[model samples]
Target: MDQTEKNVQTLFSMGFLDIEDIKNALRISHNDLSEAVAILTNDQVRYGPYSSAGPAEDVEMKDVTSTALVPTAAPPPYNSLPDAKPCSPKPDYGNTAFPQTNLYELEQRVFVDQWSIPYKKDESLAKCLIAATSLAKEGNHP
Candidate 1:
């Protein structure tokens, strides 16, 4: 709408008064800012107090300090529990899906877009692979 209509919303957003009351005030005061403000200010109790600028109803505060939060799941029984064992089938951290066979591809994947690499040691791994491959290709042992 127009600037006045926009300003009406802005006034309503100031955590005081309702749109209808603001509109009525603007209408009654012939669009005078000070007079409209005075109108809303004078008759606060008559409006039954608009809910803190938002469209939501007034929320009552409840005492939560004494109450312990309910747990999501019941604790497992101690008597029925199995003896704790070391984690079986440990993850193969060496195995990866990244370029490993080709040195050029590995170098490009490592150096070009290094940030996009998933693992922190991707560059180190790629560098090792490239070095091994270069040594192998050149018939040099190191």
Candidate 2:
């Protein structure tokens, strides 16, 4: 391969094929620099949303506020639940599968809730599952 291509391959291997890096690598060949970058990108060997320069080393960020958050009242003591006996087992939501129907198919479904909420009139079980799974993944469960 050519010298410019070899330099590009080396830069890519080091994850340093950003536009500025490439420009520096081909400093002796100003005419070939643009064309080299285009070739690298088209081959998917190099990519760019390239920063003009990397993060500054001198500027260190810090949070001035202490982690001991000031509160209006002292919080309750930890594990404050009374030493009560374990409550009775939750009754089984016996063998009930949520409706597998689409949102528009209201006429085709009938919902019945015995132990847990089955289905709302306008909301499909699938929709609820989708919403619930997303919320749970995000740790925003109610």
- TM values, all candidates: 0.28, 0.18
lDDT of each: 0.51, 0.42
Q: Which number leads on TM-score?
A: 1
lDDT of 2 by residue, 1-142 (tens): 8776676666566565485557453552343655445543443334223322235312223465776755455333222323222322432223133333432232323332211222432344445465555656668744
Tell me how candidate 2 scores on lDDT: 0.42
User: Distance (Å) between predicted and true CA of 109, model 1?
Assistant: 76
Every model: Cα RMSD to truth: 19.5, 17.8
Enumerate clash totals for all models, in the order shown.
0, 0
